[model samples]
Target chain A: MAVILITGGARSGKSRRAEMRTRAFPGQPVYVATAEALDTEMEARIAKHRARRGADWIEREVPLDLVGALVATDGGGARLVDCLTLWLSNLMHATRDWEREVTELAAALPRFKSPVVLVTNEVGLGIVPDNALARLYRDAAGTMNQTIADVADEVEFVVAGLPMKLK
Target chain B: MAVILITGGARSGKSRRAEMRTRAFPGQPVYVATAEALDTEMEARIAKHRARRGADWIEREVPLDLVGALVATDGGGARLVDCLTLWLSNLMHATRDWEREVTELAAALPRFKSPVVLVTNEVGLGIVPDNALARLYRDAAGTMNQTIADVADEVEFVVAGLPMKLK
Candidate 1:
């Protein structure tokens, strides 16, 4: 299995770029979503995303156990994790052992049957949060992205919807 | 059902307070975790939270279909959703229609057979984000908390581990 990690700031068009990259793979692509719509505006936001993705991708809304989903779908075609920051945030909000899950994901990647493209936001460039939770999220996502990058066969940083290969 | 919404910054003791408040309710209290550990530090953090929660609470890790889980667990006992911001973040990351889930949650609240304590972070109090996605998350979460508060029987804001009843 081959793993690629993608990172960029919010709305840098990382997801769109990741989508385009994943479609090049030989098999049908699977999109693992980590978002939950909680309001009207969010409803509209989700609608926009759906309109963009269309119906080609087999979508799985695995917000919490992305690792498990990734492992299960490892043999499928190409797999794209839309964003890791939201996944990290979800981990912080509910589970206590988010680190273990990350570890498991890293360990399981090489064994997976399909090529993987992991999408995440680079959160360290921003100012330190004033509160504990924000700070925790910032640090955690930063570290998680770093770990994924370290293991990934390719690392790309997106800027203004442009992808720049770092490794 | 007696529904209360808790809002706070990270580590402001919202979880602790939610736990304490739910302790007042009879029967087994349920902790609906939305987190997925993806790294070492996050694993440690999850472990710490687990230690604090002990084995008394029946834990259900529901990262995506939270409203459905809430619906299924309604009559079981008191339910505590550790945080809404993370839930919303998950929705935003995965699907485009996170608002549908929010509306479903709001609609499901009154029919809950047990008291529900919905916890969320007050992220909008801080400065606006520099990008579109961050700004979207902030705006969506803020609006979500407000909508949940409007429906809750009691609403509280937590700062530095202290809770101030807002409504």
Candidate 2:
């Protein structure tokens, strides 16, 4: 049971690389998407991403409660969470009890039966945000990434669409 | 002091409708976005939404603590939350203490000072999901919508891009 955490900067091709890595595992790939299309442009973008996913990919669009989603996919062979950064952002945007949620996700990861690839963004490299809310997001995302990274068996950083093995 | 709760199915043009409604108010609008782009597609979606918003619109992308976001926008006029379903979904996905987050959000709505529009999705309209996670999302979304509708001064349901006033 290997849980891999993939992190990178924006437009760093982290998702693409993560998807490619999923193919190396034995069973059919399960993709857990953290996206919700709120507009036409987003709808179009979602369409494009869907088109790109391999024919063998089983798509599960769960905008909330990924631990539940993961539990439901208990028999999965290979699982890939396209991005943890968005999950973190979504958590930061919705719940007041963020710390508890992070703790829950951390505890839930080890229970997965299959090889898991968790994707996230490196928010610490960017300039510090001016507003309190932005600062909060940056801090929360950075912390969540750190926590997830500590749990996974392997942690990889993608830069300019290139994957660099960190651990 | 109207407190409107806008609920609809996905891609139902509710956000655009909310934007138009906010413009009818006197002061500049406050757009509270609860989304963060975690991939290329999401980044594009965020950019597109940003393009549509005017300079007068004070954009605050609050991902987690919506009650706190509403509190900050207390004196700000015509506050429009792009969508609460997404926010609720985010909280559920991220936090272990989802009950507490939901309670806080429900408790904070009435305390809002300016006229507010709460945007969310009507997830109860769909068929029951096959799995436990999907069922949980459906149930949680239904509960959150019911809670907001109970306190809102006006509730509107959007279908095929048309708004039907409920209250």
Among the numbered candidates, top lDDT falls to: 1
For candidate 1, write residues B84-113 as lDDT tens digits.
877887888887587777887888897888
Write down the lDDT that model 2 would get. Answer: 0.75
lDDT of 2 by residue, B30-108 (tens): 9988887778986897787778776778888887888788888888688999778778778877874666777777677
Candidate 1 regions with alpha-carbon error over 4 angstroms? A1-167
A1-167: candidate 2 lDDT, tens digit per residue: 78888886544456777888777899889999887777774587568767877567888887768888888886866888976767766777777466777788889888778888888877664345566776777788778888888888898765433456789
Q: lDDT for every model?
A: 0.79, 0.75
What does the lDDT come to for candidate 1? Answer: 0.79
Highest TM-score: which candidate? 1
Alpha-carbon shift of residue A29 in model 1 (angstroms): 69
| Per-model TM against the reference | 0.52, 0.49
